[model samples]
Target: MHPPTWLTAFLDLPADEFDAAVAFWQAVTGYSLSAYRGEREEFATLLPAAGDAFLRVQSVESGPAGVHLDLHAPDQVFEVRRSPGGLAYCLVSGTESERPAPTTWEDGNRSQVDQVCIDIPPALWDDECAFWASATGWELVQGGRPEFRRLRRPARQPLNILLQRLDEPDGPVRAHLDLSADDRAAEVRRHERLGAQVDRVHEGWTVMRPPAGPVYCVTGRVPSADPT
Candidate 1:
């Protein structure tokens, strides 16, 4: 089954400048915070009604702070800790967290979507398709697939969203998705139960696959370190 649409995340800067940086969003989107961290936090809410979009300011880190993803929620809370009024993130707070593969759903509003597809090596086509399908229990495009494309919409999300047939795994791919496991063993066992294949092992970084064209990477690091 696909993951429920709820929250979305954006990263690239440090926590210190979030309040200041959001000025750009405020200027462009023309929408400002109604709730959330307000003027003192790294992340703030655009509207309490949506309650899922977040702007996470990466702190002390440099060079592509990591991923920018959206999560869905009716509760209207997407936690990011690292700013003026820093409260530990729920995921980082050692609270019960659910392990989810990249998931999405269609609310019939394409403009409202926060997830997108990226390119992958063409050779990974079948494997990537197979892997994601089995892992999330979703279906791949039956045919007429695009080359190096990104697909969204929960009703239709490609396991390997993009495909481009290149040399063996280049650097970490342009961008990669994140997966968090409650604990290392639990992460491994749960993914394993879902038919995921672990390719590399680390105290925290764990690369795995559901079936596979391109190997999907996951990290079972501590709560705060678990970037997804």
Candidate 2:
């Protein structure tokens, strides 16, 4: 079988705001910084204390901040698509070196990014989902809600992808990260202390806005299992 694809979450930010974004994210995710990449120094990777890194930050020349994914498949290539607001993703071939496994945080708070939700315009929902499904070779599962669909990775994979169909068909497509937390309330508080403001609460999930970054969610889902 082909090796499991390595997934990395990319946080795209304005050039001027990139540093603040990286600092905020590093604190919230408990990750350290890796040397910047790209000729323009627009790329930086977030390294977990152990295990493969699944997060990165990029400074874009223009446009509002957003999120996207990078899939590293040894010998695969995929077409890139740009949405209304310039959101796009591409798959490239590369080898991912393994790292030390992750351990519990010193503060004893446990959290990890377990899902990425792509917000797509209703008109492009089917096509977008098809593209991602094809790129990742993940199975598409019907979502519990009418406007949602899930592209689940294999059991051995470390992250999941979700597609959310928006009511407005002309809006820009964007994405956000979802972190699993064992103690939802405490996790929210921890992020708040680190400069994230609670945007609102939906169901049992807390929508948070980082000091100067895109919004993300902290859910009560267990970090060690598939999110409900």
lDDT tens digits by residue: candidate 2, 25-77: 88877789999888998898888776677788999998888888777778766
Please provide, for model 1 over 1-228, each residue's C-alpha lDDT reduced to its tens digit, 9 standing for 90 to 100.
224332233433455444444453343223456444435443554431222233333333334334333433345354543211121222221121222222211321111112323334544555554543443333455423334333333422211233233456533323344443334565455556555678888555566554322233454423322112
Candidate 2 lDDT score at position 81: 52
Q: What is the C-alpha lDDT of each candidate?
A: 0.37, 0.78
**Best candidate, TM-score-wise?**
2
**CA shift of 198, model 1, Å:** 40
Clash tally, candidates in order: 27, 1
Q: Over 4 Å off in model 2, which ranges?
A: 1-4, 76-86, 97-107, 225-228
Candidate 2 TM-score versus the reference: 0.87
**RMSD value for candidate 1:** 17.5
